[model samples]
Target chain A: MEIYLLILLIFMIIGSIIAIEAKSLLSSVISVGVVGFSLSIAFLMLGAPDIAITQVVVEVLILVILIRATITMDNTAIEGGGGTFPFVVSLVFFGLFLVFSFFAVQEIPKFGEPLMRVSERYLRTSAEETGATNVVTGILLDFRGYDTVGEATVLFTAIVGAFGILRRRGRKKKTEEDAEKVGILEDEDIKKDFEGF
Target chain B: MPDIDEEIRDTSKGMTSIVKTVVRFALGIIVIFGAYIVLYGHLTPGGGFAGGVILACGYIVLTLAFGRQIALRKMNNKAASILDTSGVLAFLAIGLLGYTGGYFFLNFLGRGKMFDLVSAGTIPLCNIAIGLKVTASLFAIFLALSIFGRFISSLVDEDE
Candidate 1:
């Protein structure tokens, strides 16, 4: 288990280094995606299949969005290789990160010995009270339902915010022409799409 | 660099037919799998967010495979926004209904036999609500981002 974790962590670090060094946005995005995928694997190995699955899906969506953004934008600004000062600063940061993580690892509870002061009650009563065999779901939707409410609200606000940004901003004259040229979805669909807002 | 017109033409139609065919073969299965994850959330490891993301990605795959027009026509952001709002509303309504039991989000309904599909009372309902909300939110976000991308590209072209 420790070996697998070490390997995955090393893999993730390598991916991040590549991402940091990459010249183009696309390659950087892909390398970051590698780090994400490896993290999901680490989650699976750590016995949190639920988190692993979420991580995987979220990573996929993020990758698709990043790649789409990269492709659709003008990427004329290539990154310049760093000089000695910036490189030294980054090296210092990396060393600090490594030191911090090493100490953080020492702070973590050993595997299989979780601090169950609160979860013990939750685990025992959750199935009977919430009737969910999956304790995570039970806890998420029942015992800590307020969190779920907040989560839903956050999602709602985020989507609404995104729409607000994407809403028509005085481009009425060009919308139709661009829609036709790009075979875009009809503007009428987009215009009334904000009725929920 | 290639002519903008030619490049747009090539991409706007989406990928090769072979890719479309493969996606078509896989799309139904993906939707079913997502549904299964959502419905069986109580009995399984997954719940609303994961399943919802999968469902959204299913549509996203179609959009990528078939271009934006057909997919958007099938379920536009208007419908997505509606579903998104309704999902939150349904969840709130369920929580309010818990008032009958004298607590917010109380599990008032019957907790039937364990492992049964209909067992977990409001949990299943909550999962479904969350699923709807997440699926619509994510898909709508994708649509918005992609459209925004196109808009920016067009703006750049205009500047040129």
Candidate 2:
């Protein structure tokens, strides 16, 4: 298991490198997706199957949306600061950050150990109180229900913003310049364009 | 197969006939699987977010397979917006309902036998609401982003 985790982490590092260094948008986006998928596997290896499941699906959808976005635009010219003084300085900072993070990890308890002491109460009472066998779900929906409400609010705001930015033409009774606009594409035109896609 | 293929072509509005044929079966199965994950979240590793994402992925796959027009026929962006709004409202409404008992999001209902489908007092309902909200929100975001990207690209092309 340790070996697998090590391998997955190594792959993730490679994927991150490719994601940053790739010349083409397609490869960069795909590599980042690889990184995401690898992290999900690592989560599963760490005995967090719920996080792994969410990560996998979210990663897939993000990949889809990213690929579409990149395909329609020009995104080939991404450059890291080439071998310059600032680049070297940034690299040193990154190394120092990593070392500090590793040191912080050493200060923490073992992987399976919990320091909060709150989760025990959750595990003991959640099933009886919330009637939910899954402790995570029970805690999220029952004990931390207020937090879920906040999350729902955030999601609602996001949807509202998206709709505001991309309202449909069909929603209106009439438009003075409907057919001439490129934003509102004809059904057949857009459909035929991706006939084989 | 040929008959369906021709019928699909008549629309001239999607991916290759092969993709259309396969998606007919796969899409429904994926959606159903997502719903299962949401409903059984309290008993399994999956819960609202994962299941909702999977549900949205079903619609995303449908759109990918059949193109925007065909996909929109099933559920347009506005409909998705409505569903997205309703989902969060349902969750809040449930939370408010909990107030009648004591606090916000109180587990007022009878805590039935554990491990049963109808066991979770308000957790299952919350899961369902969150699932609905997430599914619709994701799909709506995807549609808006994709269409907006295309529109921007078209504008750039015209400028060039």
| Model 2 ranges with Cα > 4 A deviation | A74-83, A99-107, A166-197, B1-8, B151-160
Fnat values, candidates in order: 0.73, 0.82
TM-score of 1: 0.82
lDDT of 2 at A49: 87
Q: What is the lDDT of residue A183 in candidate 1?
A: 65
Per-residue error for A49 in candidate 1, Å, reads 1.1
- Per-residue alpha-carbon lDDT of model 1 for A95-166, expressed as tens digits? 999999999988988877988888999988998888889889999988988889999999999999999887
Clashes of each: 0, 0
For candidate 2, lDDT tens digit of each residue in B84-134?
888988999999998898788898888899889998888899999999989
Inter-residue clash pairs, candidate 1: none
- Point to the candidate with the largest TM-score: 2
The lDDT leader among the candidates is 1
- Which DockQ values do the candidates obtain, in the order shown? 0.51, 0.53
Candidate 1 - CAPRI tier? Answer: medium
